[model samples]
Target: MTETKELSRLKLLAKRYARANRIAQHQALDLVAGELGFPNWNKLISVSKKGWLADSVQMASIEAFVTRALPAAIFRDGDPEAMARRFAHLEQAERGMIGDHTYRLQEILHEVIIAGEGWSIRIPENPGAIPIVETFTNQERECPALEPEFLQKALELARDRAVQVRAEISADWPRRSTKPDQSGMVRHPLCRGESDVWFCLHCDGKITSAQIAQNLWHCPACGASPLDIFDTAFWSDDKGESFLPVKTDGSTDRDELDFRIVDSRPKLDLTEEKIILLIRSALLDDATNISEKLGALQAEISVDDENGVWIIIEEDLWPEGKDPVQALAVAKLLGLEVERLSSWSTIPFAWPRLGEIASSTCDYTQMMLDAYAQYGGSPTK
Candidate 1:
C-alpha cells in the first residue's frame, strides 16, 4: 500500500481505539465515584476527563492517568464521536500534534494500557524522574604538560585518597565490621585474636580478650550475639586415628548429643533446643533472656545492646507432628523461621545395605541398635 493509505488506515485504527478508551475511562470514573459515595458523579467524571488533557499535566502524571482510565473507557459502549473528541483533545494536549507520530503514540499507549494493567506507566521512586537526553560540548583549553609517569602517579594518589575517605566514612557507620588506621590497615577484634572478645555478626559491637569471654561474645552495642558451637561427636577409624572434639570447659569425654529418636521414629524429643542453647552459650555468658524465650517456645526475639537492637531467631524450631505445609503455616502464625536439613536422612550409612546393616550392628552402632530394639525389632540377624 502507498504510505498515504497506510498512514490513513493507521490513523483510523488509532481513532477507533482512542474513542473506545475514553468511554471506558468515563465509565470507570463514574463507577469509582459512585462506590466512593460521591454526590455528583458528573463532576468527578468531568474533573478526571479534563485532568488527563490539561497542557500543564506532567508527562509522568499523564501517562499514569491514561494507563488506568483509557483501557476501561475503550471496553465500554458509548457515543464514538464524543469519545473520539475526548481522545483527540488528549492526543493534542499530550503531543501538541495530530500527525502519524501522534497516531502511533496513541496506538502504543493503548496497547500498554490494555496489556500492562497500569504497571507499565508507574514512575520508579529511587531514581526519581527519568533523565532527559542532553548534548555535551567539549571546549579545548591549553594546559601545562607534565611527565607521563608523574601524571600516572598523581592519578593513583587521587584514587587512594578517595578510597581512604570512603573507608573512613564507612567505618563511622554503626554496623561497620572494620576500622582503618592511618596506614589503611583494617583493625578489628576478630583480626587481633583477643582471648576475651565479644562481637556481633549483625551489628558493630565487639569487645576483645577477657571481655569477650566474660560477655560471651554478645555485642553490647547492637545486642547481636553469636550462636554457641558445640562438638556433638567425634568420628575415628579402627586404627585409633580420631579427630579431637572441640574443648568446652576442658571436658573431652562428654557423650555426643543424639539427634535421632530411640525407636528410630521421628519425634520432637530431640528438639532444636540444644542447638539454640549451644549458640547462646557460645555468644553470651548470661543468656537468661534468650533461655526464657526459648522455654516459652518463642522462636524469635529482639534484644537491645549498646550498638542497637538485634532480631534473633531459633532457625530450626518446627514441631515434629506437622508436615511441611502445616509447619510453614505454623511458622507464619508464630513468626518463626524454619531451616531444612541439607539431607533428608541425618543418619549416615554405607551403600545399599545402609539401613539393614545399621539395624544389626552393635558397639559402634549401639545407637541404631537401641532404636531398633525400642521398635520391637532385633538388632542382630
Candidate 2:
C-alpha cells in the first residue's frame, strides 16, 4: 500500500504548486487536475476513487514530472486571487490524441491552448504566431492559433458556458470520444519513411510516424493541415500510390476544433502601417477639401510595445496647429492608440470676410464641432 492517499498526494502537490506560483491552493489543485486528464479536483477524485492511495515518493516524482512538463502560468498581475478568477472557467485537462499528436486540454489564455506547449500566451510581437516556448524539449509544436484566435476562442468559450445549462454528451454534440487519447488514427501517405517514422510535407521536417498521424496530419512545427500531408517525396517521379489516399478509421478527437470554427474569426491583421492609412483617410473625411492636402502631408505612424499608435503628419495640415490633436481625439473615440510625432500650438486663421480668428486648438475643434452640429454629423463614432 502507498504511504499516503493519492488524493492527498494531489492535494499536497497542489499546495506546493500554489506556493510556487503564488496562486491559491485550490486553484492550484484545479490546475494540477487540468494537468492530469480531469476537469477539476473533484472530478479526478470521483474518477480515481478506486486508486485514491499512492506512494508519497512516487507522488513527488509525478510532481517533478509536472514541474518539467507543465508550463507555469505566470500571473503577472501579482494577485493570486486574480489569477484564480481569470482561469476559473478553464475545464480540466482532457486527454485526446489527434492522429498521432497528443494534446491535453489546458487553457493557454482564454481559448488559446498552446497545444503540447502548455498554457501560454504568444509574445505580442508575433501576434500571428503560436506561443512557442523553446526551452522545453519534449514540447516543440507550433500552430496557427494567434492573438485574434485567442480572443475569438475566449469569447466562444464564454458564450458556450453561458448557454450550457448542463454538461451532458449527446450523439449530435460535436465532442471527442470518451477516451480521446485512444482514438484511432492513420499514418499519412506522403510522409512515411519507415513503418513508424514519417516526414512532414509542409515543413519538410521529420515527425514520429505516430506524431503526424496523431496530429491529424497537421504539421506540429508549422501548423499545416491534412491537405498538405503526403506519404512520400514521390522520389524520381515514379508516380506511385504516393498521391492516393490511404484509408483510415478517422480523425483525432477535435474538441476545440468545432468550437473554434463557430466563427471563422479571421486574424485582425490591422498593422500600424494600416492604422496610419486608416486614420489619414478618416482625417480626410473629417475635414473639407483635406484629402489631397493630408495625402500630400507625409504620414508616419507607429505602434509601441505598450500598444500606443503614434501618428505624424505635416505641420501645415492644421493652420491652427490641431491636426494631431484632432486625430488623437478621433483615435481615442475609436479606442485606438495614437500618438503624434510632430505637434504645435495654434496658428490662428482668419474667417472669410470676418475678423473672427480660430486661434486655439480648442477653437478649431469647436469650429469643426459646430460645423458638424449644423451639418448633422456624427464624428466620434
Candidate 3:
C-alpha cells in the first residue's frame, strides 16, 4: 500500500479512539502504537517511513494480543482512563528476555521490573523529579545490570534530560534563568563551572560540559561529589590552560554542636518519655490522648549512638504478635532504627511476614499475594 493510504488508515484508527476516549488524536495514536507492540507514535511512524504497511492481519493480531494480555486489575479500582494510560506506558517499556525471563508490571507502584532468570535492571532515572539517580554496583555506572552496549544506550537516553533538568533546578534555585560568563558562554548556576569543559577532582575524569551536567555536576563514572569538580586539571602533570575561576560563597552543611549525634539524619529532639508517648499514640486505634488505646502494653525503649531504637515490649500483656508489629511499623515509617528486642526472639515458632510493606495486619492480605489491599472497605457515605 502507498504511504498516503497507510497514514490515512492509522489516522482513522487514531481518530476513532480519540472520539471514544475524549482524548487528543495524538494521544490515541500513541496508545494504539503502544498496544500494537510499538514504543510510541514516533516509533510507529519510523517503521512506517521504512515501508511498514497497516495490513489487516497484522492489525487484527495486535488487537487480539492486547485483548488477551490486558491485566484484570486495570478495571479493578482506579479511574479507567488513568489506569489505561499507565498500562500503555508499561507496554512501551524497553524489555529484555533471556531464558524464562520476562517483565512484570506492579500496577500499584507503577514500576516495570525487567528481570531475567537471575538478574534484573533498575534505572534510577527521573532527572526532572529526583535530582540525582545515584545507584551503582560498579565503578562506572548507575545501572548495575546494563552491559556496555545497553549502558551506552541508556546514557544517550538520559544525558540530555538530566542536564536540562539540573540546569533548570540550579537556575530556579538561584533566582535566575541561566548564568553566562564574561565571554558570553553560559556557566552553570550551581558551581559556575565552564559550560563546555570540566575535570572531576575525585575520579580524575575529563568530561565535556554536557557530560558533566548530565551526571548532576558529579563524576558519572565514579559518582563523586559536586565539590570535587573543577574547571581546571589541577592534578595534571602539566598544568592546563587558564582555568575558569568559579565564584561561590563557602557554605557547607556542618553542625558544630556541643555533643555530636553523627547519624545519617539530623536528630529529632524527643525525650525518652516523648518517644514512648509518640509510639503509643501511633499504635492507638480510634481514640486518642493515650487513655482509649488498645491492650495493657508497656514499652522500654533505648537509643544507641547510631540512633538504633531498641524496644523491649512487655509481650505478655499485648497477647497478639500483631500488636508489636504495628508499633514496629510506626517506628520503621518514622525512619527510626528499630530492632524487636528478643525475649525468646530466635526465630520463634511463628513469624509474621508483611513482604516488603514492613507491616500487614491479619485483616488485610487475605486476597491474592500480588493484589493491592484496600483499606477501610466501602466509605461510610
Note each model's CA RMSD in angstroms: 32.2, 19.2, 22.0
Summed over model 3, clashes come to: 0
Residues 190-279 of candidate 3 have per-residue lDDT tens digits of 555444566667666665554444344545555565677777787876544443323222111111211111112244677766666766
C-alpha root-mean-square deviation, candidate 2: 19.2
TM-score of 3: 0.23
TM-score for all predictions?
0.12, 0.26, 0.23
Error of 3 at 3 (Å): 39
Candidate 1: tens digits of C-alpha lDDT, residues 191-244: 433222233334323344222222222333333433421111112232212323
lDDT of each: 0.29, 0.43, 0.43
- Which sequence of candidate numbers ranks them by TM-score, best first? 2, 3, 1
Task: Supply the global lDDT for candidate 1.
Answer: 0.29
